[model samples]
Target chain A: MSFFIAHTVHDALTALSDGARPVAGGSDLVVGARHGKAPLPPHLVAIDRIAELREVHHTDSGVIIGALVTHHDIEMHALLTTSYAGLADGSALVGSPSTRNVGTLGGNVMNASPAMDTGSPLLVLGAEVELQSLRGTRRLGIAELWTGPGRTCAEPDELCVAVHLPAPAPNSNSAYLRLEYRRAMEIAVVGAAAAVTLAADGSISAVRVALTAVAPTIIEVVGLVGGTVADVAAAAAAAASEQATPISDQRASDRYRRHTVGVMAGRAVQAAARRAGGEMIPVPLNRAVGIGAAS
Target chain B: MAIGWWPSFSVPSGAYVKIDGDGSGQIITGAQECGTGAVMTLRQLAADEVGLRADDFELVYQDTSVAPYDMGATGSQTLFNNGRAVVAAAAQVAEQLRALAAQHLEANAADIVLADGVASVAGTPSASVTIAELAAQAAGGELLIGHGSGAPPAPPTTVGSTCVGDVGMAAWVAPQFSCHAVRVKLDRDTGVTRVLQVSAAHDSGTIINRVGAEGQVQGAVLMGIGQALTEGTTYDDQARQRNPALLEYKLQTCADAPTVDISFIEIATPDAGPRGAKGLAEAPNVATPAAISNALAQLVGHPVRRLPMTAERVWLSMQPAEPEVAG
Candidate 1:
């Protein structure tokens, strides 16, 4: 078995060319190994030490977050909190403190779990990933990048270098919400994220809604536009329920996931609209909606 | 009919207490801690009896080769049985120290008060000898060692033939009763339930150490929450267990812990235990699942009877009855 500490993106790709798996926090890969889910790859390239893959910056086109940015970083990043609040909220809800400290956006996206907290937000945000190899760099939309549960379309020799998020338009914002049996250390039984742009008339001019743990991949709802927040929210919720193709498993039954994802979608749309309208609100809308037990 | 040997009917246990020349002591027993704070409780009991600070004593436990035979640390029997042995051994050492001090102070052994490891004459404050001085002589070959073995007295021989129906009120030793009340919030949409708070009342005879007792109660209640809400083994159609990993068979996390309030009602059963204390380790866990289920049933307006009332099951229970179908 051979190991490589990639000092640059080129080195990481070179290592991957020899059947080495790229590991950036290794929270997921190492856990899989320890739990006997799978053996560790014979060769591994540690990409976390690469200085370039760890940057989050703003450009004229959009805010670019390096793939290695930890969930803890996203949860606390001031830029994500302002414009991409849904991604930040989803980041905050990822795993426990230890997992959040070591789990990275790159690993989460690459792992391609349908229940990924960041998946729905990235889907709604129209985020794209920059995959690099020795040959060159290629960009793919987040939705196009995933093929199935734990299977991504990215080639073995390609490494996800960064995530690109378009700048939130004027009077636009996003929010993500999920239902869990517990308050922490949970994969979303069903989740929803919404990015809405409000018209000057205080109505939703344009909106994108996405559901997690409700399909083979993050399911983005189409044809949700132009309505009062309540009308828009109800439409989005019902649409998501109809669009969801969840399966019954240990975490939740298909019927429950379908129904709950709809509810979460409705809540996400309303919350995103509220944020787009410039109202100060907390994430995890259950706390604000007074739905559960008072904390 | 004659009574034959009942293997576990009366558990045999032993403990050894040794006070060193420097006043520090060790209590050796075969009881296991199992993270249930048994070691701490034993230390407290031994310290109180020997008139030494709990911190001043060290415990050697769960070593079969060194320590005497115990029934092992099951059924919460460590504190109930082994604790009695510890108290007995420490008392023997205290008595010996008092006898040695009585000779030095020219007073009666019974009148030599053992307090704070100092043996003082009852009426004379100035006449005293520290446990260290007496232990120093013992360490120098004076031969002072305290040992004790404990077992319940033999039972009366059976008189009648093997009886079937309702054999006159069955004898129960160290009975513990506990009631758990919980408040839960059930999300109707997702079927997710969160335990908000748990309040427990226990009758575990006399309390040994309040802090350790509370810890036991709280930990048990948290485990109870797991049993009620999130813990289960899934099986496939072929009768194979599907989820063998920790990820799939979810246990309660710190975030799932609810506020717990515990109160103890002491009704000392002197004949049943040492210091009238009963086995509390299992009592607190027994009633929690029932209480949580009752709360969930009330919240969802349906009797949701199931282990690990997972979100899916609870949601299914909340659904309205389907329309009658024609045969």
Candidate 2:
């Protein structure tokens, strides 16, 4: 019923305290409302014009990505594509070119869809969501922020300001892969993301794996540690399949998702290990590994 | 790959060709232009008979009050039927031009040749007069207008078969044939099939418009791929359609298009449409789904046996059979 355009983070946080929902790109909110999934919120504040929230700043610890940074920017940024290639892979495959241009990482993180392309990659990278309000600011682990499907733990008066990612270990890289029927404008039937750190002997010193579209929220695979690349990849596959609690829907059956997520986890680990060993696999491992179509 | 589709017969089309005093022409017909360029090809047919460039003519079509009656664009018969009528009408104008030229050149009417905007005696290029000048002379007395409705060809006879409830579709006039060979890569883990390359061969008689015909084949093959893998309607137990919207019913996009190689088997038949050309629009659409289905079957060791072999269906087909338990 009412709309406000915020010029600064303080303005956006003040509007949020006044029962206004913050909208950066509105790719999910507008599209879902148009499809009769839900009605638009009565009071809305547009925060896309805030310049401070649209930056990707490098910190001594890692990197700080503003909430309004779009998928197009993240996918094309030199630092993100080189050091944080897995996140780039997820961002590049978000939607069609037009959707990627308008859809932001902040909106994706706040919407908290279990099937979101960026969720698994951010989880595997040990990212944290920074929520700000008129009172103060607080940072929560990415896993803790997502409570359930389409539900987040952040209060109504809080706005997601930035996402903080810790620097990866030396000789470490990440990769994300999804089971998609088409190359563009698709949702992942099942997907996996892996972050692998290689030891001096070309073995996996540490690794983390996460699954998408197989549970209420993006869930990470546990009990994976130092081992050969093959052993870690196999273990990640088994753990992902055992941990995922996917449901049956029109996109895919639960059985199919359970099986394919395992396959995707193994492939993601292998791709991450290859990237860690100085092999230049492309940004999206899907096309490079011949998953979707032949280019 | 598969081959199919027969051209519909006994559909009549009529046209009128009028030549102005300035040698420019107009073709009036009721054929519809539906992005296939079938109606546009009529100008080429008229130009071949009138001895002018295809661009020299203006077309007035798809209006019943001004143009002649046409069977409309359906069953891929717009080109097959309207093309013959256009050629017949243009031939009448050509005959009139030759007669007029014979009078000026003092030659036989049969020996008059029309070429390059001029009418001349068959063996003497020097004995020639421009068609525009002849049209100017004719405009003083006689108006140049020709109308024709070419009779539809009879349907092909059947040899040993007698139908019980024949609705006149049991026999075809000029049957079109095609084969589409598609190479697809399937991910066994996810049951996703991606078409890599397509080689489509069609036998639709002489290809009148090469580029337009090739485009039809390419577009149809993409549609076929959607039908094979993604397009389908789901129904619930109460006979209600579940996925009625496009968001649920998936259609392939340009990103999903494969590299298509098209070839035409040009067979000029004596008893078909104009210049032995048959219907081509719908012929290319018949074999694509089958070609993709066959490729998937070869990979899965058995047919999925569904309209659109979705990833779930293909995965279900590949599952091992359950063991029998002792009672």
Candidate 3:
């Protein structure tokens, strides 16, 4: 029943340590409560106003996106859109205009929905989350952070401060895409993200592929290394379909998800390879490639 | 593409128009304005008859205690039925105004023409009297007030037809007709269908308000798209309603609205509403779902036999048909 607004990261961590749940936009928490998925926590600390947590810092090794950096910010940011295009593609398709304006990267990561647009892209891009508390701070790989659907490994007293993403290598890029019924206000029925690095002779040298909403958590495709663009994309698609452990639900059946996620993985790899070959594809591969609705 | 729908019945409508001392007009009616601008369009009908601007009239409606009896805003009958009554009532006032102006101008009432707030002798504009002055004279003596209850038009008779439980639905009164042709882009891999363009042609008689009529068609087309592809009610094993929230019951957003091209047939007929106009609001809603369904059928090679044909259903329909087994 108690609510506190934290102006600093110190204050937010202190409130978290005192058993207060940290809230940024409350897009998930409030909506979930309204849908009777869960009740609101007894105490809440609003961390949206913390200035340091709202910044995006670029270091020598990688980029550090603040916990409060909204989907709107990440999708529109020039560096993120050009260099880390897959994450930008995922962020851009998060929700409608208003949802993107308020929903933050930290909140989406913490909510831990397997179908979250950002998760698969973050996994493919070698991203990690920085969880902080009054005791200390620690970083965990994005894959290790998610345990199950709507379940994360972070403790209640630890607030996710930022997400760290390694810089892309030369001649490398990534892309993400999802199967959506509508153009806006939609969750991914199934999705995939792929990162690709091309050698001098225009063959894929290193590649990573990840699938969303086809398992208990965002899962990576296995045994994909170096090959021609067509060979690697085809291999990723087959591996994703086989590795997926999807369950039937209202959005899609397991059979449909298994088939479509593979298609999406293959398309993502092709798009990523095209970007790596110096193609200036737009931020969202969905609209650029005409995946959802015709404008 | 598909064509369908007709207005099934008719209802009585009534209205009263009065000219006050200040030359402004007042209309009192039981017709309701349910965001469709049906009742608001009544002013245009009255203005055409009374030879005044639509803004010169003040409307008092949706008050049963004071206004005359109307069937309310249902069945797209507000403008169709109430417009006739409003024109009838305003015509009565027009007749009285011409008679009053003829007396002052020393001319016959038949020769007097009411236009632009002035009553003039047909070809002689100089010999005219202002309607405001005529209203002032009438306010001192005979008041200018008129009322009309337009009788409901009879339903058309149906021949060579037998009905089991006919609730008078076999016949139609001033039936509306429409055809919708839709162009869609569908992703075969994901089974997602997106309507790109819709060209709709409606024979809803004469259109009174072009903007309002086009808006109704566009809005209804969007609704039909939702019904064809996304909106559906799900029920659990106990017959309890599931997916009751907006999150599950998907409605079309503005982003999903297609480019709609609208055209009206503009047919004029006898024994119908004012200027032969028919009921319209619900007619455009009839053909869009069928149009979308037909378009999807062309893409998938077979009909998607379900309402709100979700991507999953469309994908299932596209799977190769299993070979029939010998009994």
Candidate 4:
């Protein structure tokens, strides 16, 4: 019932300290309220207008995307589209145009939907979320943020401020792929993201693989980070299939999710290896891979 | 058509038309226009029969007490059945108007030809009176009203209980046929599929409203694509709908719509109600899913025997090994 538009990071934290729920974009929160998915809090702090939270600037360490940075912003950002292409691919596949324009990355990371398009890519990119409160601030790896579907570990008084992604090394690039029945505005039935570093000989020097909609959380697959492209692809696919603990639901059966997750993981690795070799695979791998029209 | 007595039925449609002091008329039918253009079609039929421009007649509907009984707008019955009622009622009204005009012109009612809201002697074009003049004279106590009811003709007694021999029974008032073809692109790696384009051909007897009928097919094909790929209800373990909201139920967006090409073959069937026009409301939706599925089967060289044929399902169908092998 009460509202405040925070103009700065300090003002947002001040409102949060008063138990006002910080709302950036409110795409998820408003939808949840409309559908009665969750009770609307009595007090709301509008953090979308906070100048600092809308920043998308490179730091000495890496790229910093403010919490208010929208999915559309990430999809069209010059630097992220080039360096963190996997995340950009994931961003491009998020919801639809209106959703991408209004749905912020902070809401996606904090809402913690299991089928989120950006989760697996962020995991592969080694992204971290910065949570601020009146008490102080803390950073947690993307993988450590989720407790379950629509649940996150951050305290109610803590507000997500930004996402930090360490820059990719030379000769490294990444890709994300998701299985959708339609071309636009879909939750991934199953998805995979791979960040690959290619050696001069065109073999995968290192890689990190993550699977979405396969488990309670976005899961990282190991042991395929260092191998030839073919070898890494096969291992990542096998590992993802073995590790996936999906449950049967209407979107997909557990068996189908497990199998397709493996396929996507392998394809993600293949695409990432190609990108690492200096091929410019576009974001939203579906459009480039025959599922949608090319730009 | 074979002669077998199937249960033949008629849909009761009621309509009332009022010719005002002005040259215009008003048609009141109980049919609801749920975006199928029933009101527009009714207006066109009534206007043509009453010898007025389509824009001169306005239509009002859905006031049950004020308007006559109509068998609602479902089953594509609005145009075929209610359309008959309006035309018949307006035809009667036109007859009366011609009779009045004939009296004034010193001609027979049969010799008076009605066109452009004017009643004139067929041979003597100058001997004519505008509908507005006659309507004004008939106002007050002599209100000009037209009423009509329409239904399908009864079946012949020879129609047996069962369709016998090689003959197909034609029990309904109108029969329709349609075909749909779709082109799709399948991503083998991610199991994602997008409908690139769709073409639909329809034989809905006669075409009454060309634009309305074509728009019907276009909308139906898009909805069919949703049913074939993304639209479904999910239930929780407790027998509750899990994804009751539109956000989760996954209806197709504008971006998901494919290029649509529509064609109509107007073959006049005698029993197609009033205007040789058949009911085509649900016809376009009937064959789309099967067409899309067949296209996918041809694309992947595998049977797509599932509703929605999601990328996960298509991908799993393509895999030779089972998930237990990985487990």
| Top candidate (DockQ) | 3
Tens-digit per-residue lDDT, B1-327, candidate 3: 999776736777789999999998988998877866764578888877877888888788545978988888777778777888898899999999999989999999999998888889998999999989999999998988989877777656655565722445423667788999999888887788889999999988888888888888888888899999999888777977677777778889888888999999987765667887777777777899999999999988888888888877777788887331110
> Candidate 4's residue-wise lDDT over A179-236, tens digit each?
7766676778899999999899999888999999988888899766587899999999
TM-score of each: 0.91, 0.88, 0.91, 0.88
Please give the CA lDDT of all the candidate structures.
Answer: 0.81, 0.86, 0.87, 0.81
TM-score of 2: 0.88
The CAPRI category of model 2 is medium
- DockQ order, best first, reads 3, 1, 2, 4
By lDDT, who's the top model here?
3
TM-score-wise, the better of 1 and 3 is 1
Alpha carbon lDDT at A148, candidate 2:
97
Model 3 / residue B156 / CA error / Å: 2.5
B42-143 per-residue lDDT for model 2 (tens digits): 888887787777777878854586788887877777778888899899999989988899999999989998888899998899999998888887788677
Alpha-carbon shift of residue A217 in model 2 (angstroms): 2.3
lDDT per residue for candidate 1 within A168-240, as digits (tens), equals: 8999999998887766777888989999999999999999999999889887998887699999999999999
lDDT of 3 by residue, A178-275 (tens): 98888789899899999999999999999999999999999999999889999999999899899999997667778889989999999999999999
Candidate 1 vs. true structure, TM-score: 0.91
Tens digit of per-residue lDDT, candidate 2, span A115-171: 899999999999999999988999999999999999999999999999999998899
Off by over 4 Å in 2: A1-4, A292-295, B5-10, B15-30, B51-72, B89-148, B162-171, B322-327
Clash numbers, per candidate: 0, 0, 0, 4
A-chain TM-score in candidate 3? 0.98
True contacts kept of 2: 0.46
- What is the interface root-mean-square deviation of candidate 4? 2.7
Clashing pairs in 1: none
TM-score of chain A in every predicted structure? 0.97, 0.98, 0.98, 0.96
Computed on C-alpha atoms, the DockQ of candidate 3 is 0.61
